[model samples]
Target: MLASTTTTTQISSPPQQKFSLWSPPNPSTFYCSSQLLSKPNKHSQKLQYTERILDQATNILSVLYPTSTKTFSNKPLASLKTFIRDFLKKSKTTFSTLQLALLYLVNLKKSFQNLSFLQENIQLLSDPIFKCGRRMFLASLVIASKVVLEPAPKNIAWSKLSGLPITEINNAERLLLSALNYRVVLPFEEFVEWNILLHSPTVELFQKINLVLKKEIWEGKSNEEDGPHYFVHYQGWKEKWDEWVPESRGLKMTEENLKKQKDLVAAHTTKKPEKKSEATAPSSERGKKRKSEHVDTVDEFAKRVEIKIPIPEELKIKLVDDWETVTKNQRLVSLPRDPTVTQILQKYREHIINNPTSFNEKEGLKSSVFQEEIVEQVTDGLKLYFDKALGNILLYRFERFQYVQLKEKLNNENNGSNNGTEKLGEATHAEKCMSDYYGAEHLLRLFVQLPSLIAHTNMETDAVNVLKDHFALFLQWMVENADELFLKEYEHASAQYLVDAKNCTS
Candidate 1:
């Protein structure tokens, strides 16, 4: 990828013109949409612009990258908004810059390459090159701020403020600029015009003209009750008036949909139940049988949805033992694991390559599963997932210090005297990879949570079953070689490391 460049344009301030609902003057050819210039409703007075804009952005991300939204953290949208708010507060930037950043974010996704690649890979729940969704958006925000803010903070400073690793921020910027083809500049007139349009009085109120992107369960609904719902954002009204309505209701208030909803409700209410024969069994027995059948059906649906990844009894016991050691005894897994995850994955790949038939037989496969390219993709995805998840959920309290220290060490190594050209699009040193410092122990935790991650993906039933089979095979392999692959014991953290951790936390 080429180095990113910014082109700034300056425009002279224009004299203020009298504002009108339909006829607004523009220095640029850009014009507001008719929907934005629609008449305001009475409830428009209660509209809050900033929160509404943020919510819309969040909805877009949720629709685009549902798996990442589910995998990264709980309530990822809330976290994204909080990050933006905190950055603005700490950086003390003007609200105009925030609006500018949001524009860049929306445009960045509009790039065909960016959106296409993400839409394709995000379904697989892994991207080998880029951290998808929220992280990418956050990185774009940083880049946009640099373009708009005078004497903008360096990537390191941004890293400090955002709590992202300098390397990650650097990589994100590089990847994002490549995807965007380095066309991120906005003219002063266009920026101001968009800003005006977004805040226009005639703009559709977030509450009155809401978008219905997908079928989601609303509050007070069970998982099984989830269905397509339209958000009714009243045109030219405040977000407070926004409400969720069933699919029977149109995107906005429509008499047709309202009648449809009413008809459907009445049909359900007036529907007659099928009568059972009383000659075969007593009412109590029949009722018991019906209840059992209902219970079984719900259980089946729950199992399919939850997708419990199979863990062997022995491995479960081992995880339990490991948990006790870490949580009760306050022991830490030793860092820079022997036969690190990368090494183990490489070994597995080699084993499959050499003894293709044996591996296939072990997995009960008749067809050749020896495609090196496919094998590489699977291993790479697992490694990436492990690295992403370790920082989020896999680490125990005691192991967190090691994780931080390892990251700092990798940063130091990459920035060392001998390797200064990494910033110029050089490949990262293999030894400096995050997966190089963690082993099967942490990777195993990711597999246990893999079902939850996979559940959020758009993978088909067959693909999910294939994934489960592959995982079970690999896990069995790990158990067979548990003595060599798994960590046998954990040691207490050194006193100095503990003190450093305390200081860091404080």
Candidate 2:
């Protein structure tokens, strides 16, 4: 069923004024509407900033390691922080503190001519990336451990000084290893160590016991005809070092080796599927067939469902009033009747459990039937409410839970659909059907739920598109509108669950 709405007048803002610290002018501040704020703009900005930092670090490394052939650059690296101020300025976004601290660390590293001297002193405090100080040190150690003599020094005491559980440090070590692509040689540390070793032990030993050891090199002099050895001990070390560290042997680059590396990288990298031309009969025909299939499926389902579910008018009006009251006070609205909602939701769960679909028997039986049922019931009920225009306002508050759950289910199925041809196609079709059906259903649900009428709105298309375009926005709205006190408790419990998972995994 198509969920359509009538629009109303747009909410106008006051005239612009000079910017001030107290009233900072930004889109995030001016458009406090949850609908407007739900767009991926903020998230895109955050990703962009992360890419920029990585790019900057890559450039710094390239400068330091000019001889290295490896390159580290991504296309979207520079566009990472355009609208970041909007989100970072808000105190509610806890990641801002973590982002700032990370930036500070990066800046400190860039300032140093050589990071080796400052390596031991570096420590991160409850940073989001590391999560704790021990994690931070462990991540650094994963890079620098080879250079330092007492890598995990007892005197440093990670547990006591960092105040982190030993388990978290271990987990962080694994994460860092994965992030660095398991390249144990960490070129930066290797280079730093090579420099130190060359100056102290290698050079001094060669000079002291020289048998025909180029005395002119120590006298701060050089001859043009002295050949390659006069420049540096490149050949001598290249020969000796290979024997000393067999793992580092045969490291010379050649045309064949270069081609092999390129081929391997190309094979591993994901290639975008070729898009079919609009004129192609197969692509056009498939689109038409899909549309007809959806229409037929929906029509048949509607016809079978002869009973019209009765919605409580009093409940609808109460929800509308509650939504308005909460929005006015800049607070999230609680579920009107939590026990009643929960009970109705539970009933729907039973319906799904008792009624078996072929796919459900194989897939649903493997998962938490209770959780699956809860999600299905919640989604179906919300769709019903939206189709009837019973209570658009309150319904928006719970919309996100449905979107997240559906997306997660689709992702899980996609990952596990490789068993057989019949199962594979069925899984793929099921994922697509669920995604598109729920997406459209949820969009229509939001259209009916908005406080303002959609009919006469100035930005009618924009408003409609807002509901249709982004599911993430709906999730954000649900979190914002849901009861804050309950949400805080839920989040705390959730965080604890994550911490417990980390502990178990460790």
Candidate 3:
């Protein structure tokens, strides 16, 4: 955390506070500015302004980066700009993430001069042709977003946005982390310095022209340290937009300038004239038509799907409970379970055998839902479905890291076994599939999205209805055995695990 201070007080020893990886120092803490404290904080507007500035900066970079490219040829700047803009739009990246990204890029550039600083092999970055330019900056932005955002954008999302494979994105992130020696935290002084260096007044600032200065910050890098940076606030704007402006910017708050700024602000804030309201009868008729059209749209969507699974209220409560434990409480199901999905299906099959009357068995021997052979066939199909969909859609955001790690581990083990290097007592490579590693917790997630998935398939209506019935019955069976099937409690992921996942090193 940054040290706090008063405007007139002498610098004294502040309480020692340990830096937290999850929580960065607030911009407010780095300043002693108290002016315009009464203005209502508009965080949403501030975030929008920050995004606009960053977007403009990238556009500026596009113009400045490559001057030598042939007029008819493709430019790297266009690709870089598109990649950055898409990620920002799709991910809805926060202001803090963007700011930290700039800081990370600067630090990475500094490290490029000293190759000895990096521990891991970063040949991809060290190539003379690559230079610490567009690619490195993009990588730094990805790394910063991962570090600063909770439930960060998944590797798959990053891959799609960057037009790279998931493995490549992961590799880039890992290399960038090593380049910075994992020092992702930005120092308070560095932040202040950068703000002062790149600070510029756009139309947003001029239109919000109520100015206030709080405290003076000495420019530390200079020999004389004579130039001071002050936190400049637009009285009507958010405190977040109140940034450190250096003396070098030569911004004057004289009376005439203030009056001119106010005039501009008035002009910008002026409202457009509204058209006259329509007659009440026409307006009411139009509203009814819109409502009818909305209903028709929903009906059309419903008609496209052949099946609808009705979730029981008790099941809904269970889902809510599960979400509470997994997401809100930061708890996760342990992996490589004793009673895996395959094992659970086997148990359910056995249960049908032990209690024949419990399941919905048809009266005729010609066609029975729970016939031994039919049950076996259904369970086999279910196991295959679970394996296919788990990595793609069944996982929660927090579970994604573990899922990837577990998958790679299983693949390695299977490969080793195939190479005749497996331990005598360990499970064979054939049994190490996802169905044998993940159990009810993961399987339950599949059921939630299964309806929509099944709807999209080209199955006959009869087959879909039959499959839907089987799914419903299976879920009911699982519910009955919830005590043994469901995870009652989950362990919290360790700090190291989270760090590794965030850094894409796991």
Please provide TM-scores, in order, for all candidate models, with all chains considered together: 0.43, 0.19, 0.40
Sorted on TM-score, best first, the list reads: 1, 3, 2
Candidate 2 per-residue lDDT, tens place, 1-506, comes to 11112211121232332110011100111111233223345334333333333233222222221222121121122211221222222211222122222322232333333355235334431234433222333344323332222222321243334444445444554444443334433222222222222222222323322323344223442445432221122221331222111212322222244467669879977676767766677876898996664444323212211111222343334334544443343233222223233233344455445554633454443233324533453344333333223211223332333333444665566655644343211334433323133222123234333322221112224323332222232233333334421222111124443344323310
CA-lDDT, candidates in order: 0.53, 0.31, 0.52
Q: For residue 76, give model 3's deviation from the true position in Å.
A: 33
Best by TM-score: 1
Instruction: Tell me the TM-score of model 2.
Output: 0.19
lDDT of 2: 0.31
At residue 193, candidate 1 shows an lDDT of 42
lDDT of 3 by residue, 1-506 (tens): 11121111111222332211112212211110111112224343233333444444453233222223332113343444344544565556544565667666545545545547444456655643234245555566677666555456666676666565565556656666766667775553344333322323432222221121111122245444544543344533543464555566543432345567779989998977655776566867997996664344333222323456765566666776766676567677887776899899999878765666745444232235556765675676566556655654455555667877887787677767677565222336364778888888777765665553444233445555556666777787877787888776788889887776455421
Q: Which residue runs does candidate 2 get wrong by more than 4 Å?
A: 1-37, 48-136, 139-325, 328-341, 358-506
Give, for candidate 2, the lowest lDDT window spanning 10 residues.
20-29
Clashing pairs in model 3, backbone N/Cα/C closer than 3 A: none
Better of 2 and 3 by TM-score: 3
* Colliding pairs, model 2: 6-454, 6-455, 7-453, 7-454, 7-455, 7-456, 8-457, 48-80, 49-80, 392-449
